[model samples]
Target: MALRPLHPSTTPLFVAIFFLSFGALLFQFVQTRMFSAMLDYHLTFLVVSGALLGVAGGGTAAAVMDVRARRPSSAQLSIAGAVATIVALAIETRIDPVSSGMFVAAGVAYVLGVIPVLCVSWVIVRALREAPEKSGLLYASDLAGAATGGVLGYLSIGTLGGQGLYGVVAGTALLGAAALLVPRPSRVPLRVGLLVVAIATTAVLSIWGETLAPPRPGPFKSDTMGVPHEFARWDPLARIDVARIGDLGDPGHYAFLIGQGYAGPRPPALMMTLDMGAFTPIVMHATDADLAVFDASVLAAPYAVAPRDSVLIVGPGGGIDVLNALRQGVKSVTAVEVNRTEVALMRGPYSEYSGGLYLDPRVHIFEDEARSFVRRSPELYDVLAITVVDSFAALTAGAYALTENYLYTEEAMLDYLGHLTPDGVIAITRWYRDPPAEIARTVGIADGALRRLGNDHPERSIAVLKHGLLGLVLTRNGPFTSLDMQRLRTFADQRGFSIALDPLAPGGQLVDLASAEAPPTDDKPFFFDSVAVSDILAGRAQLPYGYAVLLTTLVLSLTMATVFVLIPVYRGARRAAGNALPPGTVVALALGIGFIAAELVLLQRLTLYLGQPALALSIGLAALLGGAAAGSAVSPRVPLGLRSSAVASAVVLLLVLGGVPLVTSATLAAPLEARVVIAALAALIVGIPLGTIFPRLVAIVGQPALVSWVWAVNGTASVVGATVGTIIALVGGFTLLGLVAVVCYAVAAMFAPQPRT
Candidate 1:
């Protein structure tokens, strides 16, 4: 065998690390995603995610820059590394790493990214440059460590508390140190004997991170960036993964993830179903069979009058109310849900044999956002039950989702009375951390509206909610109510509800619907949407001083272009600098941008086309996630940078181009076609570029030192670009931004002159 160079080929090892780091990154992302979805203000997560990535990118770039320059010995780099590590530590100490907002979050992200990127890049470059013979081993080692972090991080949430972020930071830091201290025969170890000092600093910070987590209902705190869903706590015992659920006071607000993994059956506990929680939480608990036969099931339950009685249930997820109605022996149950993903999950799992029940004949699930469904559904019921909304916290999303429309809309009252037979009863429930005075006003208003409904139909609508409130409105239509203190005693005993609902204040009042037109659109009624959800991912979205997160995003996006595409392409172009793109890439980027544009356009159109924006977005997102997952799994096997990747990328582009018209298919699920198209586009975006980049990156990097160093710089550029992209979109909307993305890709493709093999 021939003698090897100082740093051996460790490409495999680096690949392994990339693979491993993905596990951790995936876990972290999943946790953040779930938390974002359940939060009251999801924009908060977006800010935080962007912040963290921004910092990580910057930090990686800085370190990589030092390594690429080959300016110092391992010793000098080590000293700088230690100092950067200390800077990171100092930053952490200066600010609590738990808040989520504009300035502070941006600062922390910037600091974290700059320091680490610099440090890690330095260490890896040093390792390869010094022990050229062991370059392969060097890559393998980095990959191993990253992989460990990735897998363990996600699977460890139940056990880890607020220490996960610290764990990542600490581990990354320690690895940098190890890389520095390795045999540097090529250069002397810098005489910066901060080893003991660094170790001491680490020990102190570890202790602080362990003890500094705030108390329950904490105004601010940290949690493990672990699991398929991040678990945050007001108290450790009351852990919930919701978006922006608190502003300190325990009674202010709340939101939580209700379902288990995949499409598993939701827990049907008494608290979950009729209590305050996600529809999945409530429906999964109450529903047993699929929707088709639910009418007969709920009516046959011990509490109903007759098997054929009518039943109405609002808010669809698992369609358990439909099942309950079927159990009750009702002839039919009209089920409605605001989110469409749940509907797709039900049908797919049942029909595709993915592990859910399918329909035979009895249940019909209507895919409509609850508000529009109420306005349009012509069906009426004997027992009207609403198991939606958690209005306990008005400052949170409850203000919008559980507004006057659900309570006092002219159409809602009429629909309730229209469906029920004589003496039909309507029941509803919600959790109240603090039943604001507005809630009492709501009760009175709903009564007044019911009286108006009774002025005509008069079957009466009774609303019952917990936290000590019961509303019994008597419409002149009939004697539907059956109670007082005596009935309360029996109902509470039988239903296992605490003695929290006592109907006394204004038993029957008149409502003024004309005056209560819509939920106030002022600051108070603002609910979380996609734009808002992005800012709250991991802890707070703060950054260290002197650094701007938006600046960082722009920096990283550009850096990514430079490191992975632009610079490398420029260098390649220098070899053939004036050469034009092969034309394939131009087509690819153009179509790619088109695909992204279509996703947003279709989402906007859903409200007008199908009367449901949330549902379309949900289905689209779910499918996109699925596509990305598949792409990630398939990429490596194809071998990075191969002509195969280029071909695959071309095919993906072609598919996106072809699929645009079919997005509005005339099938039973014309709505679903958009989702599938979105999924295909997402996979193409992630896979084509990724597969193409890595192979070329391996070639452009040339040596281990270059590989480590170049990655960081690119990362930094990407952060900057991303911020710029977000800003542009905010100013001009998705159409303009999408065009920009396409342009960027086109410019890159035109300039990147790859030589034929």
Candidate 2:
């Protein structure tokens, strides 16, 4: 049947594959680290372009082997693979910006794309020569190693980190070469001395690599990032990657039942992200509340008990809603929380630390998002107090935020309105900085829209909208007293703030736009309505890219795929029976990589627009994983005749999956932490199916021993596609990445054999 792998003499061929794989991978790790050392995470990608060039060179070598068919001996092929890998790395050193100067960065990346292809080609050639009868054995061996590399890297990198990762890469390669000399009955001993020298060289270089620096705490500081985070000055553009507790209050001491999520330290004031602004009389008299607590700090609440009734406070901190309600005299209070960070601090490390009022036994705390508890709980509040930042638009964008949708939407309004005692009123307060008449008009529209829910105003509710760009509205569906207004005015005056009813023209707020089923989608998304804001706050949205690079890439790709591949195929450069992928395939792969590079360039634009680099990274990582998973799974089952077709399907799927997220504002606004987790889980679910595809395909082509070889080729292709995908996202942007995936699949499809027996 098949015996190439069992022949034992091919051990050298396996060793060569090991050497090349490890060597090239080591080189890449070093390249990456050096860039980081330069304080540049972005530049290494261009260097990766150089790495891919090495891979591309391997592809060229593969074609050369196909032409030389059966002409090279196993030893000859092994020697060639090793020499080629060395040559590729040496060449990379000259062009890689990490080692070379920065002037040729982009050009170097473009040129480097040719190297890895070449190295991969040489390894493939060696495997083929060693086991011509066992078609895919090289692939299995390589992938098995890949699995090992992944696990070891994961476990070790945490300890070793960036520079350490390079050390591992270098060590693995050097050790691999040493392992080759252990086998007997061949010239293994002759190479032992040389292998020792290589190991020594790697060691010496590791010491002088300059990429490595002395260990220090806050490890990212050691990298070449020119400026250590400790030394780095704060800029709004420089987002806070590391989370730290800004303030901690003990809940037992200062109990707060704010609708906003609970966040405070144990035994202190119980509160969340909202630290009280000067919204309360007690807080105004107190010192800490007046200072900007946590950038738009809303309030810190203290819990207390009243004699008879059970009380539910939404936002306990702002102006002491619970304390006032207690004075208004409530028996007990229940609070809801969403942002766990807020609740944990209040309930966790620093409870009772914030203030004196948190010790009340009448207060019951719930650390969950508001709507969720409300949806499940049968208990209704006698008075639901909603304390939020002002100016619906600005509020929606920042921490102290809420929207008109909650009050205006049919479902939301009904939910709160239904639960309200004929006298139970939900209170809301919004904030602003430099508000204008038009801004007031929008607020007026928001308030007017709420009247649809049977909201009644003692003072024609719109009366709360006032000057100073900051206003507070106290709207209710029930009759209330001037005494209540006096208490609110008293609280406001104590906090250096004043409020009066909003002045309206003709019919107040002057508008007809709020009646639509959903928020208006004009130049800017009009989604700050309470209901919509609630949906957003609760984490529901599509999470697609916006200002997508997709549109331009799509058009350019049509022109590109035509020019890069079609031209070659039309010239008969890709006859399946011939060697080297008809030259057109090679050109297409390179061009596809180029297009991907372009898309990566476009992603920067998105980052610039949204001012969120994390979003860009999320998009890039998702596409990378998705594409690798797809190719790995489908490559095996792909019929020789339908290869191109399957790849085409994959291309379209990636495009839809990755690029579509940019189009929907709802999706764009969704938290990436949740979205990315979901996508990664999806990719993981399909991993096994994809992983098994190659084994099955290799089995179809050759005996079990040969399957390993095929797996290697597949892994190599996947690595190529993944690296290229990231580049497209980084350089060309994600749109180009999708296009490249499409192109790769189409290339595979075009190579699909016409049906024949």
Top-scoring candidate (TM-score)? 1
Candidate 1 residue-wise lDDT, 1-757, digit = tens? 1112333444433442333233233223323322222222222233333433433343233333433534464335434544553454344334532354333543453445344334344454444434443433444354344434433443343244333333444434433434334446542333133334445554554445434432111111222221122123211111233222222111111112211111332332111111112323223322344322222221222233222555656764445455556555667666765444355545753233212322526666676544445444555556666643433332232223211123333334454555556656555433333322233333344454466564432223333333233222222125324453345445434433333323333232222221232322211121111122233445343322112333444554454445543343333323332354322333333333333443343333332223333333433333433343344344445454334444454455445434433442232133444444544354335333423432343343344433333343344334444444444543454445544544444444443434334
Model 2 has a clash total of: 139
| Model 2 spans > 4 angstroms off | 1-8, 15-50, 61-121, 125-133, 178-751, 754-757
In order, the Cα lDDT scores of the candidates are 0.37, 0.38
- RMSD value for candidate 1: 14.5
The TM-score that candidate 2 achieves is 0.42
- TM-score list, all predictions: 0.43, 0.42
Evaluated at residue 104, the lDDT of candidate 1 is 56
- The parts of candidate 1 lying over 4 Å away from their true place are 1-6, 9-102, 121-154, 168-212, 215-689, 694-713, 724-743, 754-757
